[model samples]
Target: SVILFLNKVVISQVICKALLVPINPLFVCSRHIRNRYKRISASKMESATEPGESVAGKSTAMTAGQKKEDRMKRFRELHLKRNEARKLNHQEMVEEDKRLKLPSNWEAKKARMEWELQEGEKKNDCLARGEDYERVKLLEVSAEDAERWERKKKKKNPDPGFSGYAEAQLRQYHRLTKQIRPDMEEYEKQREACGEDFHPTTNSLIHGTHVPSKQGIDRMVEDVSEKQIEKRAKYSRRRAYNDDADIDYINERNAKFNKKAERFYGKYTAEIKQNLERGTAV
Candidate 1:
């Protein structure tokens, strides 16, 4: 019984020793480091909260007058900042204007005008001496005038040489004597069969017919001449307004006309005048 008890005791001690033995040194070190970090974090938290509490207490203790003064100081600082920014912007704008501004071209224009005046005087002197103006005017001839001159020259001399002239004349003769097409000949015969008594509207029902109409050049010329004469008469009437006698005559005539109008529509005029006085007339 004593040996059995001793063996059991040895077995219990061995189990307890095995349990107490360190499995890993790193795990023991990590646990110790974590506990230290926790204590330090708690102390840091307390320190941080202390300053925040003091700021809260100070802000709560501030008076209304002190708050107003602080607000005014902030506003003044903002205004000064804005003024400085504006001055910087204005300075930049002025610098940009100076850099981009163009110099005037008036001197160049004056020089050109003086040169043109001298050329004009030279041309006038040449004209007075009966010299040919063609050479002097060559520089001033525009593309339009040159084209017009070429067209006029071509019209005056269509065929430049004898061979060209002969060919053109032959072509003209052939065009005049050209044989008519069968269709056109048939059309002409059908037209003749219709007779002068047949109305164009009735003939058009079968086949369309185009008749040449006169342009009436004389009538157009007469109309234009009449318009020009009327325009001159109108101008004369307008010019007469500048004369004292004509003005007096016109005023007298207008006065007489107004009197006639007043007699004819006296009642309507009186009503209009009354409405105008009352500010009711449009």
Candidate 2:
């Protein structure tokens, strides 16, 4: 019994020595790591996240409200800085306008009046031509002869509803007379008595100069070329009130309209050349 007990004691010591020695591991479980290790890994992940975001705790960075306040502060600073530039540009525009001596809208009123007079003269000329044509037609044959001839022509294929020369005269008068206001007649008579020569093509004042639609106060920064646009994209540190997306959209639309106009004018010119080749009036 003593020898058996001594052998068991020796075996126990050998097992303990084997456990104390280090050896290569056949397998390792990731789950066996300490909670402290897990916490360290989680902290690294949180630090890698964007500002205003946190994995296991509230973000220490500015909130949405604080961001808005910061943006407003920046805007105020920029506006204050650019105030002189705005004033200088406005002064320049005003001085330029004064030097050019731009006319008021009422400056064209007299030209419009002259245009009206020319139109009246044209109308009178048309009426005179019509009257001359009728007179010549009447002189070619007597009224009685015309009536007799018309009756004979109709009688050749007469029906019960053959109204005579008086009916024809009534129809002619109705066709010649158009409605005219009493005021328009008086105006025309006054215009005729003035003996003024009003011709549209002869008078440069008749066509007024075209004014720009916008005051240029809010015009987008000029970008005339694609290369310039790309350069702007790369280096434009100054931000606009509007988004870049809207500017790009407008540029694309303008390009489309320009392309369309070019195509239309190209086709129009081609058609004109073809007409000339074929000896057709264009």
Highest TM-score, which number?
A: 1
Where is model 1 poorest over a 10-residue stretch in terms of lDDT?
Answer: 237-246
Model 1 has a clash total of 0
lDDT per model, in order? 0.68, 0.59
TM-score for model 1? Answer: 0.17
Model 2 per-residue lDDT tens digits across residues 1-282: 456545655665576678895332221223223544888899988877744355323433446667889999999999987997899999999988885785675458768989989767766786877755445546678879999999999879532221345755676466435532245665566456444533335543524433323422223233225544687479635323434432323574674564455445867777775687799955
- Which portions of model 1 miss their true places by more than 4 Å? 1-22, 63-282
Q: Write the per-residue lDDT of candidate 1 for residues 86-141, one digit (tens) a residue.
A: 99999999987975674477568779999999888887898999876677678788
In terms of lDDT, the best-performing candidate is 1
Model 2: CA > 4 A from native: 1-282
Q: List the residue pairs that clash in candidate 1.
A: none
For each candidate in turn, give its C-alpha RMSD to the true structure in angstroms: 32.7, 38.4
